[model samples]
Target: MRRLLRTTWANTVLLALVLSFVTTTAVFAKNLDVSLTELFPSDRQVKTTLVINKVLERFHYRRFQLTREFAAQTLDNYFEDLDINRLFFLERDVTRFISNAGQLHDQLQQGKVDIAFDIFRIYRMRVDSRIEYALALLDQPFNFSRDETYQFDRSKSAWPVNEQQLNDIWRKRVKNDFLTLRLAGKNDDEILKQLRKRYEGIMRRIHQFTVDDVYQTFVNAYIRTLEPHTAYMSPSTSENFDISMRLSLEGIGAVLGADNEYTVIQRTIPGGPARQSGQVRTGDSIVGVAQGLDGDMEDVVGWRLQDVVDKIRGPKGSVVRLQILPKAEGTASRRLREVTLVRKEIALEDQAAKSSIITIPTDAGAAQRIGVIEIPAFYRDFRAESEGNPDFRSTTRDVRQLVTQLKKQQVSGLVIDLRGNGGGSLTEATSLTGLFIRQGPVVQVKDAFGKIEVESDPDPDIIYDGPLAVIVDRNSASASEIFVGAIQDYGRGLIIGEPTFGKGTVQTLVDLNRYVPGDNTDLGRLRLTMAEFFRISGGSTQLKGVEPDIHFDLGIAGSDQGERSLENALPWSKISTASYTQHHSINNVQHLKARSAQRTAQESGFQMLMSRSRILSEIEAEDTVSLQEQIRRRESDQREQVLKEERHRFLRAQGIEPVDEDAESPDEEALEKQQKVIDKIQTRESAHILTDFIQMQWNTAYEQRTAK
Candidate 1:
């Protein structure tokens, strides 16, 4: 299971669970009236913290001294982790904590974490007070005619200076919440009932927080200050991580994370029912969940991630419905929609490499058959292989067979589509590259001590050597970057589409129990970023990912997404280029780009996609929304209409009928059809580009022969 799991999502899922458990428990446990003294760090947590500090100080890839500055930064991060929007913590509270920032380093080293608990107690008190205030506000009728604005994204805003200022903010907040539900067509009574339940749920969640949760949160707050990728998981979180790696859980295969109070969809697993549904997407917030078709929807906006996961996961073949707030709508928008999906086990076969043939018509009335292979992830059944099984399922083995089949079909060119492939096994990445070029170095790994190890393609055999192209998007990362980097460095193929996700660092899970020897206590685990990957060509795909030879506008800006956007992310660096042979040179890359650009401009589908991207970008740029009912309604309707028109235009361009706005969820056949249409837009274009490259190569060879 460890060998098979290499994607960042695994670490992300673990960290998210840790955060979710710690962040929401206090809100839910208010009714229990837990004593504040019980929330202090335990002896076990103290020992674990000391061990974690030692491990990171000695082995973490990024090295830094535990100075006052570092302590201050960690303190700030802890505050942010607890109250991301600066809603609960007042200006006085922040000022009070600032005095302890300089002493945090010394206290942590001495296994003292009383300050973490102190701040948490104040935060819980603030939450309880705010919920009561909000409940009281629900009794008064809001005047929708007033022209006002609510700044929902308060991450950058200053904390409230006093109780009055805080009250005003909450007043606007509760008003915005009421207006959102009213806009969604709910009556005043329904809106008031829902708001009261939501506020009370917040209190209930906070009351559920335990001492362990507080300890985990503080440790992670310190760890995250060192690097975004590194995290400390609790025992329960470690158990869940193991379950995910084993693929034994039955659920909608979505990796979830906490974005403030909402449980946002990080990424859907390749073989999961969520991925197959065509409704779930990264960044969508699951606000409500219901079991079966007729079950009443239970609101889960502020619920713990573990609680939400428990609800979403069920026996295979059972139905689960999700009320999603699409990410593009912004937090202020209340355009909630529900999607129904059947639970299923995420099987290995569903995520394996698959092949297809795309026929492109030529100017000479002949059709060029282009072989397309989609690799969802780089996977390997290591346990099966170690047992001496002759045919172990791996990305390399499966892709090698697929290449052979494509060759037998006499494909004019080949396209390896790696869009949304978050990456997996590193061994599989190197082995897979071997099938393309002769034996050579694929990637380089550098440890904290600066020791470099080169991973190379051991096999001297080449599978398919014809005109080749690799398609990548923002999601292609880790092992995927390793493979694509090698392909580009060797000039083995033309890289197409968006820049790859910059995630070149390597993480290893370390069991804390191992350090204690015979101790029976489950000390949880630490996902330590101990190494960094460098391309064979010298550059590291850390913050700046591999640039494609031919680019496509996929509605995403490379800078604002992926590893580059993460705080405390490792910077891009370089090393000496490795020794390797260039298989082929693409001399006409500029001409190919021009050809692709022309075709893209003429395609209606591309135009529609670009338009939709602009609309989403506009929405993402706004930090405030109008609180005036009529103004807000006008803006919302206009935005919805534009988005609807774009969708209809895209559907018409593809010769598919657009579903109505209030249409029921599409069945499997309809979803498959929609997926095919979406796939055709990109894959078909890639096939055309590959065909163009093939012709260019043929023409160049003919010219060289004539000259000779």
Candidate 2:
């Protein structure tokens, strides 16, 4: 499928998801209800509010306890752990919490009561004290160890973990931070700090990071008013997420999640350090991890997942020892295994576009070669750009380069594959479709104010003016739909896959800058869906993805996995007219559709795949789990295998010899015959077979252009 990096969309799939649509020419303000100084509370209110916040937080978290006393006791115990003195007059507050816990729970659950202003008044006072304390530390140097234990330094005994050390870390972060700042064209340190502070503040407001149980309670209360996807992640939790997204390989070499103390393995990425070792298995828990083969093993019980991830990740060729706690007990004592793995890219193939060629015989004359280009996503080198490189990686440029390469081979027709592509940067998709169409409007977006704007093709030069086809399944969403819809509307390509994964809307990544103290930290992306794209034909591609001209029996239906399946997604519908010149070439669509239908029915592979898909679908829908159920599953799977075997046998039984799935792949004998056939109008079985080869469909496409 052709995946697009452009963050564009269509249809009502997304809007229907929210159960609301913006009125035409409407204007509204986002109610970000926040007091900038909430986190930086007044000193007097800090203590009172902090205690209330923590108490409420504990109640919200362990709500299953139901009883106020039990929940309060749990909260008290938790605070004692963050700091012994954290719970000053703990018993008094615990007693008070127990008395009001039921009332608070009932009121909040009913959405009729809130003690927030009163509770937060106290919380702010305590937050003020905490802020004052945290700010104090900012002036002091960071703590350090001058001893040999500090590893990086030993000759000087050890560096002091004083304010100097804190300054050093801050200074060290400057390199990456300043890189971003420079790109923003900001230089003054004071201004940068202000921006960073604003970003950090967003963490506390939208994402409440509190040890205070009561504060957590209010945050959850606030969040419940919105949809399920909106959330408030703690500061520490946010930090952990940032690390996970950036981590590569080394160490124990596994992605993990926690089910209590067990570090359960997620998927072991192929060709990654974990997969290469071949010793680890999914469902295996890493009970212990050590830096080296004989290094001291640390039992990673109840530790944060990121902390465990840290122990297991390192530079390539590093050795990490792990004790695998068997998924089943009594298998063996924790097995100690050491794996020295080199870090490699796990999603390397997914990072770039892939291509293929399909050949099909025509009814009256010869076969056609159809080139398929599958773009995964549009990606950019953000780091390179931040590093002052004007020219860096981008999807538009990448597709341009790939299309040029395919053209050199002289393909007859081309199919842009955009299935399962969830959309990315808007710039990429807009530029990408321009590679096919001459300069004109590609997508028309209508904002809430009924402000309509037509985004024109960024480039006017056509890359290849060949017979074009676009393949999109239900998974082809957002930008995928935009490009496909444009090409189809322009009569530039025939969309041949199932209806796209319709995602009609555009989302802007809202930077949490307003709440941060400094831009140096707490930066994050919030994707907010807005606007919708309408086709020139007066139809929206939102919920209703682009339908193919040649409707082949691909095992996909809208209700099954399309945008229609998504919760809070947009719906399918038509829109009003926008003037557009109808491309004259589209008049032949009916004939093209008919021609494709007859050709597909004659293909053995198509028949076999459809039958296999049906059987698999049936097997998947079963509810049985007994040994008898196993028998049925085996029978179902075997049927698919048998069908394949028989087809192979049928080919062998024919005069045609067995060959790899690549047709027109230059068998020495075929190559010699090709020259003779090319020299004269020679009628031979091999020539017909070669012309109709489905495996090397690209070759057939190439021949179509040359044969003409």
Candidate 3:
């Protein structure tokens, strides 16, 4: 229940649901006929579907079933899944499909899947016609001077009434594509070639989609209606899902899923090539992939997620180039970036807890030496532990070693930087919490059946009792939240930075083949949400993530991110607090807040970050862009320059050396490692914040000692 993409299948059906909203329902007199012959579902698919539905009914966190009300949701999910962009199916087609909304549940329960396939047939026909229109527009010269705007997000807009209206929309879409390339320095002929290839790629991919693809989409659409995290993987995607579960998989290290027509980056593995590259990010669209330094980019806009993943993965040490279309918050106009990464096996050494010592200058001549430990993840070697290996690798074990070293240096305070640390092993979280405080409950678990269990700290002795601060961000989630939440509840440390990613549920992977005996067929898997995690203080970290005691104004913080942003996510709730004694009290929280705010206002890095955040907000708020080529080009250049200048300024302020403009990295692997070093600088400012906190606490303690 962490901030994971949840197998290879969760959130795969989001766009479909978004585009399937009912704006104006119309009844059609046309008789739509469908039969099981058209579906051609395999025996495995039928059995898997039935078993998945049963699991959802019995063990899912959400208990609502395939009633008439839920059936309407299923129909909308189906229509939207088929035509997420609203470019293919006409208003009348949707109207004709509306009549079957109430009866879909009964038909599906009886193993009748003809409705989904029949609806898909109409969608295919519409796609063929639309592709022809889009292809025809590629030949015409567009008037760039016209001040016409294309609505990119048409989820709320009414569907096109006729073929003429739809053609007009496609014409604008093609022109916009041409203009984006033109601004990127492509000539007219080159633009035409690229656009034609891209459009044709879409057509080919649409036509090549197998029956399984339609079935998977429809089934996932239903699964998502139950909950955002519950998902059903197809036989082929199941293989990819299993591969994704393993940390040692040799690939680019980024999880991928379909978002409308694009393959979006879901989560970058903590020690993977993509995470180290600093070029690819969550929500970025991989539009094309190429091998080596100079290779032809394959247009992948309309390709399936499995196909995209296959192209990105290769032998270790090989380079893959990804054509990235960054996720624009509220606008459709986004610039493209190309990132190159050398594939490698994810090594545990790269993700181990790293320690550094910072000597912070305090009031007068006193100086405080603070220990900083950057924990990239809460990982534990389950196989090693299960085999009873004496030296099993885990966050708690690695951190203990680092703390021992820091203690030998006689550091006055400790800062556990959990920024980008998405949760891993829950046991590691509990054990790590044990390192700081005496034995107590670390977190609580509640199942759908209302059974509650409390996980304890699992240790009685405290190792380090000095002033501690835990730095977290929006990406800090699940097990991270459990640990951070415990620290705050026990009054053992100050929680710094943005709120944690609210993910408190527990998911178990159920193999469908297990239920159907004597079946050699691959029935895929179901990732079902069955339980929830809560803090020892009784507060649930579901939609409401753990709030920081000393909040920082980071760009991603306070934005519409985390569990609350997801649809059908569980609500926040509270239970009776666990019995635990407070470890220590800072006593001067207001003063600390005031002093930190004063310093942040004057800090050059923070100022630059705030400015860039404002620019991003403005960009997101914009509904239209100037169609004029010169205006568009100038705007793009200005935005890029501002960001570049701000980044350089921030780096200079942090006293970190910037990458040499003239010194290009020899290859992708070297560049990625270099980028990882650069990303670590951003955390330097957080270290400074922790230093300030320590100094403030030291001053207060020193004054109290003098008074005594």
Candidate 4:
């Protein structure tokens, strides 16, 4: 399953004081017919709030206090969560809310969430008004000749000072919407009809928001002030989370997150239907979903994220079709591409470790073969293992088999590719690290009470002692950081690629019902941060992450991405280093780094990768888009041309023919070929670097023998 972070279930019992809370409140019932305009905090929500505040304050790793200052921060986060673009609420509205921040701290202690509801009420009004205004604008024709620009990203912008200022912003936004459709070859009538439906759909969904939604949003805003990873899941959301963890749902295996009104694809799970389709990409928005091959496509624009997901999920072996708005086309583009997929159960075997070989030509007649193992996640079947299934699946067990097979192939070196791995089981991480080392500590865990526990390798065998390299990227996090950090600390392998995601903290899912025993009201769950991870070398991977010995310039700056970019993230710290023997395998790191740098500089493939990275970086840096039709079209074309030329170069370098830039999505075979070309560019270079190290070791041994 695709997850935001590594999580464990908390086994500790709730405090006696928390368990003593009176559960006399009427159980909140879900009623679709309830008026959203008069939303109020339920008695159950009040009780849940008190428990949440107590739990967070007493048990969270940060030990956060509900101070007046924190209350103000929560209010700010709540406002941003509701109106991120600064397009709805006025300056006076924000000021009015800010003035009451001082009193919010005390009110919250009494479980009075009236202020949250009050602000949301006004927010709903603003949303309704804005959508109404936008709908009206669709009837009017926009002048494409005007050289205007729309500031699409206004998260940091000041709120509109007055109604007139707000209207101007909305006017530009509506015009840009129209222009985007026009450029996509839609006629004026089509554009108008789509825009009207889209606007009305937005209003309709907002009106459908229930009391639970309001409470979840408000509580999470407060939770974020404590840490980014800690979150509150509503009862419904909790059920969905459970379904995901169990991997029981049959659907497109893609994680979805809301980006404003659009349901954006966060990632595709390995071995899932979405990944097998090869057409769905991260950042793409699902604008429409249909059941079966012949079902009518339902327009899902502006729908609730869960509702959209419900529309897409179905029984095993059933076919589902998705109308995707490609991320490369930007948000304004109306062009949609459809993909059909057969949903299937995402089994453990689907995500099993896979192995391959990369051959590098040496100066001598013989070529050097380097084995590459790609681990999508650190996974294990705990139930199967507990049941004494001798062949239970696990990352370490799978990799051990792969290593044995690779050795049979007589590969000179090995590479572990963990570029997009977001981590999994903690035990798997420790065991996986043990596969490369004899016996030593792998990682250190510090609990909320400052108790440090050293997680050591249980096995004493070194499975693969050959020249090794671990490739990581920004998405490599949690357990991934633990494994790579240990390898780097013990000098067992070379750490390559970008820095890992600096998520050193560990979270545990807490069942709220466990605290309030008498209440059968289904209070949902809390994912709370409870511990921090440190490398055996004493340095924490909290915010700094694990920096590679040989860095790959992938456009993203380390400081601007990963845990460092998150709000309220724990700072990097150090503990007493554990005693472990270093292999001294990477003694010639400087020489290896220089050689890799020199080779990559001259390599055409690396040059093209860097060029593509630069263009993407430039695009991400722009916060505004040109509203003028001619200028916008020219810019879009230029970007496409540059990217297309780079793709052609890459294809040629791989000895493959380049396809047309405007061509439809490629078939599964073509996608596999393209993926291979991408994999070679990164993995092949790492293989070459490892081969250099192997050759250097041979030369050093020869010189020493001669001297002796």
Candidate 5:
């Protein structure tokens, strides 16, 4: 399962998932009596829901008690799930729902789910009213010169006080939508037509929502209230999850979710076409998708997320074109760009660890060749292993070979780049950690009942023990944290870059369909958080993650991007440190750090990266945009030009010539290769860091011999 960011909007957007399609565009009438009985969870579903709820209440690592407090939290979460932007439900509606919050626990215990349906009914009515008002607003011409701003992020704002207030909100929403299309180069008539279709699609999708859909959404809201990682996946979603885990699908390798009308990228799978293309990014909106190079673009803005995904997935070796609306830079508007990628099966080779040599400059007019191993994930072919394949693919096996090859090349130092490695098999993490160290405990696991299990290195032999560094970023998580933490604990290497993603809990998927007697229908699955990971140093890598010895602030850290940013995340704690020998200690890390700081201060590449971060932060913080088309276009173009200049300047400073301005744009293959080159700049810097480390080691050894 994809780990969702802590942003409420991101989670709520995912709830707008696969609703069964309906042909009719039913405009809901005010007096329509939508039956709550039909909208509630089925007997089997309710049975499964209750079973999982009980399990979480008792066996979850947090062991949260089922009390009125939890009940109220669940109630708040349900409202947020239904109407995160505070656009649909009124303050009165929320107040009325509060009276039912304290009774939710009792209701769930008895398997009475009328409350969810009742609240959903009110939400549906509100959506209908807003859609009607928004459509009516389009009838009047928008005043772009009014100098008004729309609060796009209203998740924290209070609900409108009255109908007129709500209408005013819709008025701005409609205007913003109009302005967005206009900025996208759409004319007045085309903008109106598209907006009308978008509103119609929203109504159609909501009307098509099944009882199972509503129940799944509400159950997930309840589950999330318990903990962010724990989740209930409906049967259909369970199948998709299995497919994702199997890595069998031939597609762009992106996890797509609905964000209002747009199908947004949730996460890009490692070794997938989307990730390889380097164009698709998290939060980018897929406005249009096309087949082949010359196929007509299919507008996907108002389509079902699953439908859009289907269009993107195809036979291996096929090309899919995506018209992307990048996440607005800060508060500025986004421009659309087209990216083409060839769909392919995400083979083991794609994610396997690879090695390269980077030459680090030295003071004596010499250079040290450092080996850089880029590990995208801690992956393993579980099926092959289960089938008794002796040569089963795994991260440790791949890296071991890469280290051997690098050693053959006579590289002076080593750096393992784990940035954006979200992690995979825990077994691989332990085994990989074993590669760089002698035998010892790699990580510890703590159960809900306080039983601690030590997972130790299976191999006593060290593969590569040269001067080493591990480069990580905010997306490095779970098993990545485990490996990096073990390295730190053992004094085996220096860690560089920002703190990791801090996801240390272990989750187990329970198939609910298995427990239902004689039920062949789709009974969902439950992902329950069962255990927490503790580093050998006694500290839990839960919320704190693994802090680097040398930190590089690429400006991506400290956002709502890690476990600590999550709501109700488990707190950091420590136990008795595992008894282990420190194979190698970095006594000169402070001196090395000082040298790195000096270089970073004067290095053009580092300074350029800092500038990029500042621009990104500014773009992210801007929640409002100017409605005037010319001003919006001018600001966007100016930002784009500035970014282009920064890129060229950085390249020139690195002694690499910038591409000719009038030259034809690179093809898909060239673009993918260029992405690899761009990614290696950091690796080059890491090699430099490792070079400093190696120099410090030699100096320390020489001084010790002289003193002796």
Candidate 6:
């Protein structure tokens, strides 16, 4: 609803019936093989199909089933779900839209070029029509004009609970969006007005795109049939994913969702106001907001979701309040809990590079250090690189510096952490792997055809020839897979962690502006999944992420952690082996694994995690939920309490004061315990295994080097 892709707001007036199916009179026969009445029983149905077809055709798509009956139902659903009845626009505007929508449907089915022009012309009319109205209210205080009071809950009260009242409810909604942007530092002065005018001018041309949206949507629908992830990126929405993954947006700490009024907290950023407060939940919905508590809470009904987000966002340290509506059942209304939050800068540290030290004891009671470097993503600021700056930020550059620092700490073994890294810059991923292995093809990319392009580490010298291991998780995707796979293919190091994040497709951002010439310069960008990355073994890293040699459970409470959890991801299948040669020795790795398996069986921490996983799975698999089931739930709570008590008893045995079990307030003691536990487990792993696996391998490699 809040079309943030910067397209002009058209208020979608003209798609009432699709004329693709004509009256059986045989007046039209240009690939029009069906009866309009059969496709659409009513004029409204016909218009909806027409709109659907126009948008579908743009993707140069093939195959679709839009029956007139389905079109009506779809429209009904869309309107109900979006609460279109609560629109703040004038009745005349809505009526015109309904009329135009029908005409457009006819033109679309007829395959008329005029249909394209109609899209532009009509969208221009709608945007131009509203510009003055929006301008009139731009400087005004937030006003709902309390025109009506209608209980909008249809299930509770059937029929129109005062249609005009519903309209008034939505009318107040759009104003809030304008205010949100202004609060986020956009002044409603003359300068911003000019900027908006320019941006909107460019946006309108993009919106009038008669062919592109339909084509892309069609492609997406088709792909959705196969799987969700394998689809065409509409040229207008390109680079959007890249922007999101990098954590570089300005404004509020919240992430945007499709629906205008609802939001899902992706990850609460650390050091931000939300994190500092620790009250705003990850899945909380921002039902309403106020500049402050005393400010009136406007009903954000029928508002574009992103517009609501814009309203809540502000400069760092600025106070804002969100009326949180958490997820709930239809029978139960989500509580409108008010939370006062402050705006602050947030960064994705979890996605950044990290390092760890695994202490392994040798036979002589001496401690050897194995430093682990975790590269979550291949990050680089190309904008910085192009400016002739040596300080151009990059993962490879950062890891190389980290290597120098790690060596200075006298570490004998190194673990490159690729677990949970979704990958970034192709260049950085390739170059980073070269730091470990002496150059070769890191990954082979194949396009639409069988043709493959092998991307190699364009370098031949190994950065660290010491005993090495690469720690990977199910989330190690794309370039992360390439790096880990290459290392394993050449037998350069040990691979640990679960299977990686199986995103192996290569996407190129296509700007719509390139196709549509002048006046549409700001047309959205598209990211087409153009190619798949293959390892030297000819097997594609599709649904399967890289598997670790020494696999360890992810220790997540109940969630799936790696390769198979993602939806619509490409399938994991292997092609015939490519002509390649193995280059390193894991002869000692098999031996270490035999020892590690035996040792891990005795570790209380490992056993605790495994047992906890079983209990967690049982909890997740339960489906019973009713008021009567509350007693059963209390029993389950008692079971959890028992587990907590046992854990506390164990902590007590270790001379650690177990955290309190009040469970209602913030768990400060629990957090402290968790940190300490993670520290104890990861730090003592080398000695716990009773074998200096990395060190033994390193010494073997060193002796091999010396023998040569």
Maximum-TM-score candidate: 1
lDDT (10s digit) by residue, model 1, range 1-708: 223134433554334433332111121212355677788877888789878888988989999568888888888889998888888888989988877787777888886788888989999999999999999999898998998888887888898899899899999999998998888677899889888888998887787777877778888888888899888888866766665544444668777877767898877777777777777777788888999998988888767676776667666788889988877566555577788888776678988999999999876677899999999988888668889999989999999999999999899999999988877778888889999998999998888888888888888999988889999988889889999999999999989989988998878778999989988888899988888889999999888888998999756556778898788899899999999888877887888889888998888777766776776777767778888988877777777777677667878877888765344656655665665586667788889999988887778889999999
Per-residue alpha-carbon lDDT of candidate 4 for residues 1-708, written as tens digits (9 for 90 to 100):
012123372111111001111111112233354376559989989888988988887889998788899999999999988888898999999899888997788878987788999899899999989998888887787888888789888888999999899999999999987887687677999878878877887777777778988999999999999899888988976765554444444567777777666788867777777777667777788887888989977768667666676677666788888888777656544456788888776677888899999998876657999999999988888779779999999999999999999999999999999987878787889999999999899999998888888888978998998899999988788889999999999999999999888989887778888888887898898878888999999999899999999887756556767798888899999999998988775778888889888888988778777876776566557778888888878876776666667778878877888644234555765665565576568888899888888888888999999999
lDDT of 3 by residue, 1-708 (tens): 232322211222221111111111111122133332444666656677788877887878767577866767777877777777787888999887677676677776865566677788778778778888888888777898887776554555688999988988787777777887776556899888888888876666666656677788888888877788777777866654444434234667676778767788766777777777666677677878999999998878766665566567666777888877765322233366777778787677777899998776765567778888999877777668779999999899999999999999998888899987877777788899999998999998887778788888757888888888888888888889999999999999988888888988777767788877887888787777888888989999887889988888755436468787776788899888887888877567776678777877887767666766776677655545566666676677677667667767766665655554213343545446545544554455555566677767667779999999
Instruction: Give residue 559's error in model 2 in angstroms.
Output: 0.2
Give the C-alpha miss distance for residue 664 in model 5, angstroms.
9.7
Residue-wise C-alpha lDDT for candidate 2, range 1-708, written one tens digit per residue: 011113222112222211111111111222354553444323222333232333334322112223445334433332332222221122333345446656654544433223443444444444344434444444443222221111111111222244444334333232222232332234456434643453344234332322332343444333322212223333343443344334432233344655433466643433345544444555566756776556865656434354456566555554666656433221111122333344343443434676655554554456655565667654555557679997777777777777787777666666666654655555566778788877777777765345667767746688877666665555566667777788878877566657776666554323343434344543232333445677756688777777776555636334645566544355565666666554535444555455455654665545544564565455334322222223323443465355446445544434345433223222434333332222111111112222333323455568999999
Query: Sort by TM-score, best first: what order?
Result: 1, 4, 5, 3, 6, 2
lDDT of 5: 0.75
Number of clashing pairs per prediction, in order = 18, 81, 0, 0, 4, 43
- Shift of residue 530 alpha carbon in model 1, Å: 1.3
- Tens-digit lDDT string for candidate 6 (413-441): 78775644556566776788789877677
What TM-score number comes out for model 3? 0.89
Compared with the true structure, model 4 gives a TM-score of: 0.93
Model 5 off-target regions past 4 Å? 1-37, 239-247, 257-263, 291-311, 328-331, 513-522, 557-559, 653-666
Better of 1 and 5 by TM-score: 1
Error of 1 at 432 (Å): 0.8
Model 6 segments beyond 4 Å from truth?
1-223, 230-248, 251-313, 319-343, 346-356, 512-525, 554-568, 575-581, 588-590, 632-636, 639-691, 695-708
lDDT of each model, Cα atoms only?
A: 0.81, 0.46, 0.73, 0.80, 0.75, 0.50
Q: What is the RMSD of candidate 6?
A: 14.6
Candidate 5 displacement at residue 597 in angstroms: 2.2
Better of 5 and 6 by lDDT: 5
Q: Residue 620's C-alpha lDDT in candidate 1?
A: 68
Order of candidate numbers by lDDT, starting with the best: 1, 4, 5, 3, 6, 2
Best by lDDT: 1
